[model samples]
Target: MTSYVEALEHLNQTVELHEKWDLEKISQIIARPNATNIQIVGTNGKGTTALFLQKILCAHGFNVGLFTSPHLVNVTERIRYNANCISANEFGKVYMELRDIFDEKQLSYFEKLMVVAAEFFCRHPVDFVIWEAGLGGRLDATTAIKNDIVLFTPIAKDHSEYLGDTLEQIAYEKFFVSQYAKKVYSSPQSQIVQNFMQKQAEIYCKEIFFIPQVSNFYIAETGTVFDIDNQKITIPMLGKHYAQNAALAWNAAQQTLKQKFSVEAGKQALENAAWPGRLQIVQRNADKYVFCCAHNMHSLQSDLEVLKVLREKDILSKNTGVIFAVTRNRPAQQHLQMISKIFPNIVVTAANAQHPIPQELQQQNYAIANEFGDAVRVLQKQGIHDYLIIGSIYLVGEAYKYLELEVRS
Candidate 1:
């Protein structure tokens, strides 16, 4: 294909069905068993948590291949090796090698990417292949590869249509990744999910442990600092969730490296670890911007709480402008109302045209900005110096494009 986008378009011509997902064929195509697979499964925070783990492993000087889904900008962002995005040229070239498999096996869009990521990782000297499940774990394409260590992020009610409708059910579906895991780590989760995961581990005869509670846990306008495993860690991030992610990465790395790993290396990893679009901060002159990827209600609540704390500390202005967008399937109005409760004025727009046309926010203070430039214009005209764009990662990409925000390291 001429371009990665074109290759995807061509793949779209294939019918969408399970018959196209021949994992057996995919495995044979990229048969390399040198890499240890790490599957991170969750409803939210999986991307950030996976990045956390990847960053720590890289800091320890391990070759890491990381893959996450639903790219905001280029598709290459979904695949990386040692913290570097895979170039489209390389991605296209590798994918072309398996062109016949695409036609013969009928791999769907997501399945195609999974095979592509696996094949690319196999060709490299990657020591750790961190695969972040795109959705439900059991039937996810990544599940085709049995993981050596499985990290469970916070699983809540998301993708209910396919996964399940209830929290317990969703949690149960996600824990399937742990069935074959040699080791398992849990991020702080709801009581129901934590219990469900423990039960699953019992059935699988695998021991599962949650990230130990940190001592002297503190969140402030400056940053977050905590003590875990007798190690003092500081991450310059707003939320406690980030600190928990750091601990998960640290624990997982410790489990892998054993005595060779040092507390000092863990601290350095946490300090430098950052996942863009997750409470990401950007500045333009005197004005400031905070980009958060709050997709579902669970994540939205978490990010809102962070903002609440920031507002209370007077770090973030009590009043600000919001650029909000959500996927079409979700109730746009609910997100609008929730965001309105904080920032009354909002610019409602589509993150990308792929999203269903956004419903007009039927509020006197809200404006519809189809164009990113127009969205910025509305916020600028309102004299809102502090701006927050949230709801969907795709929307964050759109805002980043307009603002020219640099990609995170």
Candidate 2:
């Protein structure tokens, strides 16, 4: 029996997307398994939204399986059953059980894991399984499965290379995944994006429930608290967008009950649910640091706005220091300019994800580091008490690992 670690390493090393990307054939391995699958797609918000749904449904006493991408720490973080990680031992068991099928399908790194998740669900028998698309919905691997519901998070122009240049084009690619979805719940979006989604609902003949949001929510350094209708909910984390994600989950949960959703589970699930990397806090001695995965221009805007509010509430300080690194494709100058508007001096470092520091970023009044730790050391030496880091989730994940910080859920 190859160990789980060994098997995962082998699979990851062998599978390549350019060689094979047939999700339909890979999905067939677990196609006959008894499960009600829901696929959520968007440029942002899918991971948090999926996590919210998982916590809600699980709190409702239903067995739930959740699949999300770009794990901040362990790869096993990508798959969960009833709020518990599918253990490496079990993961290896399932992987070996279907190892031959995966080799035959020639699955990609992502597709390989998704299939494993599907198999894990098949073995455990869950009430519902939520799959978050790794990329654009219509063409992504998750759409290969026959899903019961599809949720659309707020779409944006992040992955311009594969999805499209404009928001409309990206919106179309993501919305089309729900063509066969019996029900669709979407978060509030830009008017143009909302209109496009409504058009998709009309074309697919599926009902679209636009989830209502509360903008003036509460955010404390400890966490954020807000309500969904009559349900008073609190998350042990930061970010205003999280409140919106929780609301989207409430709407989706209502669909499963076949009646008005229960606020009963809302309190417990919202309070306990752990979403890593988005406004995550790390405390080293007396110094406190906040790390958020605000990768793109739109996400940066949302993150900076939240920071401003936190500053108002004393959750953050005017003297806060931010460390940032962006993926190579996005306009580095614009991203750096946005940061400069909110933060005067920041640390710039090469991300473990391997995106080089942009020249424009170097031109700014920023400190450079050979690695993320060096950047943090620069702050630590200066006796900086507050550190706020934001950029790609990959960058955040790298920092998470380098710091050996254990993040909650």
Candidate 3:
């Protein structure tokens, strides 16, 4: 029997994506015909949206399995049942069972994880399986399975290399997975992109519903409240963007389970749902750190809006400093410029070799650190207790590791 450590070693040897393979054939090996699957795809908010939907369904007395990517602290975080991640022992057992098939199929790292999730869910049958795409919906491994319901978070221009350079191209790529879905829904997007998507849906003879933004909302220091269908829904997480995700989840849940929808259950689910590393606050000694995964330009704008609102409401200090980092593929200059407009005290750093400290960022008046831990040290020496750490998801993961915090559902 392969241990979890050995399984991870095998997975680490594989690449993130492969140019060619038969994902459908491999996925069908563990396909559960009765298991309803919801596939979510977007540039940002896929993980959070899936989480919100999972919690909502589970609260309504349905067993749900959630599969997401880029685990913050542990690989087990990718395969979750209801709200808890798959235990390491179970993960090792499943991985060992699939090892021979994995080698035969030449599966990529993501494909192996997807296979594990599919098999795990099939064995422990759930009412629904929420599959969050690892990349663009068209070629994403999650697409290999039949998506009973396909949902799209706000589409943006990130991952242009694989998806597309233009917004229309990106939207079309994400819409591909919806071709066979029983129902399709999306959050509000740019007018141009929405028009493009609508035209595409019409050509395919599939109707796509676009969810409107949450209108009635109140924000306090603790959380935000939104009035949905005259039902006061309160979520513990801050920001209107989170409210939008909750609203979308509520609408989707109602649509998916028309007669089964329970207001009390939905409210409880929304209140309990928590997404870490997005405006996540960590306390270490006397210092406080705020971590957010706003890697791309679109997400950065959304996160900054939340920060601005927090400052205006006096929930967050206006003098809060920020530690910024970026992957090499991202435009460092543009990100730094955007952050500088709102935050004067900025410290730049990198999480790993893939994300090198940009020369442009270093040339600025901002302080630089070799990595996330070093950045925290730099802030500590300067006596800056309240600061925001924003950038790549990898950076946020590093922050969690440095703070010795474990990520949970």
Candidate 4:
């Protein structure tokens, strides 16, 4: 048998064939003997919300563990401590110990990682664990854990095949985490999601906290300011959507701590919170490049809004070239339509995988490239400035590697 690191590499090369619910054996292996405080974050803002909560809790003197999915560049980015990626040595050590158990039981890649993360936290004794669901909430491996608080970010149309078709059906699947949670907090979603969540709340007997939408948000070239829980706070991140994510994270942290969060603490934490590959700016040859992993149509729409704001403010220009790609699972037409609306000059390319690309796009643009490096080379050859890379996380990860930007510490 190969080492755990080698096994992880092999797993990444193959397609994920196991069901999400089949992770029960792995979960049982990592179950802590003590009552572990858990919060399962779902939907769009899972990474940001989890990072924010981890920062706030660490400030308040709590050991925090955050597990997020679809790492930007390295697999180690998926597991973090207060916004910092764990070291490769530490990861290898943990994997070596857990590999024995996994090999004995034959756990999947995701399942093996979950068990290692849980056992690492148990031994280290973290005060709270923020676990982001890999996919939809219903059968997600993270759902196996009993949660102290469950958080649902905006439920937009995404992962249609596995989750569902309509927004209501998708909302129902995400709400499944509430069953294992003591309480739940959700941002203001669509009417369908709100209605579904209400029904689920009643059945689960869990108190649901709704984060009201921010009526007034101020955005500038430097950052953004918004009222979260009636406290006006300035964050070092752009986008009106980020304010909503922060609000949800704030409410969840307050609920978990069972106290009014310090305004100064919340403000500082929000300012410091960082999640790479989402509206993240990279500088190359004195030009700005924005790399976002907007795989689904809804997420792409959000990124488009931010780009529009930037263009209006002269932060980004209309001539900015877009490096776009999509996975086989997503709706390519909808993604291309929405992206074309925002970015007039897009260079469509394929991510470094066997994912399908639309034939129509291939015929129209003739911009398809075999690998991420080739895609970057093609964009650079065109003398394009202010580049924006959008589409699947795999594309964003490859771009991150090419740019060599350090992951947030």
Candidate 1's C-alpha runs over 4 A off are: 1-33, 360-365
Best by TM-score: 3
| Candidate 1 local lDDT, 1-409, one digit each (tens) | 4866666666656566643345466555554437889999988778877887888888889999998987766777888999799887888887777778877776777778777888888888998999999778877778778789899878888777778899888887789878878989988787877887788788989899788755687776556888877777777766777777777878888888898787777778778877777887677887888888898888898888888776677667776888887775676777778877877878877777767345444443567888566777888887778888888888888877877776765
Every candidate's lDDT: 0.79, 0.80, 0.83, 0.74
Candidate structures ordered by TM-score, highest first? 3, 2, 4, 1
lDDT of 2 by residue, 1-409 (tens): 3568777776668634533456567656655347778998887788888998988888888888998897877778888998688788888888887778767777777887888888788888788899999988776888888688888888989778777888899999888877778888888999999998888788888788988776558887668877767666778767778888888887788777756456777678878887888887777777777888888877788888888887787766777787877777877678778877777668888767447777777777678986778887888887778888877777788788877887567
Question: How many residue-pair clashes does candidate 3 contain?
Answer: 0
Sort by lDDT, best first: 3, 2, 1, 4
What local lDDT does model 1 show for residue 42?
86
Model 2 clash pairs?
none
lDDT accuracy of residue 107 in candidate 2: 73
Model 4 RMSD in angstroms: 2.4
| TM values, all candidates | 0.92, 0.92, 0.94, 0.92
Q: After aligning candidate 3 to the native by TM-score, how far in Å is the CA of 220 from where it should be?
A: 1.6
Total backbone collisions for each predicted model: 1, 0, 0, 0
Better of 1 and 2 by lDDT: 2
At residue 16, give the lDDT of candidate 3. 53
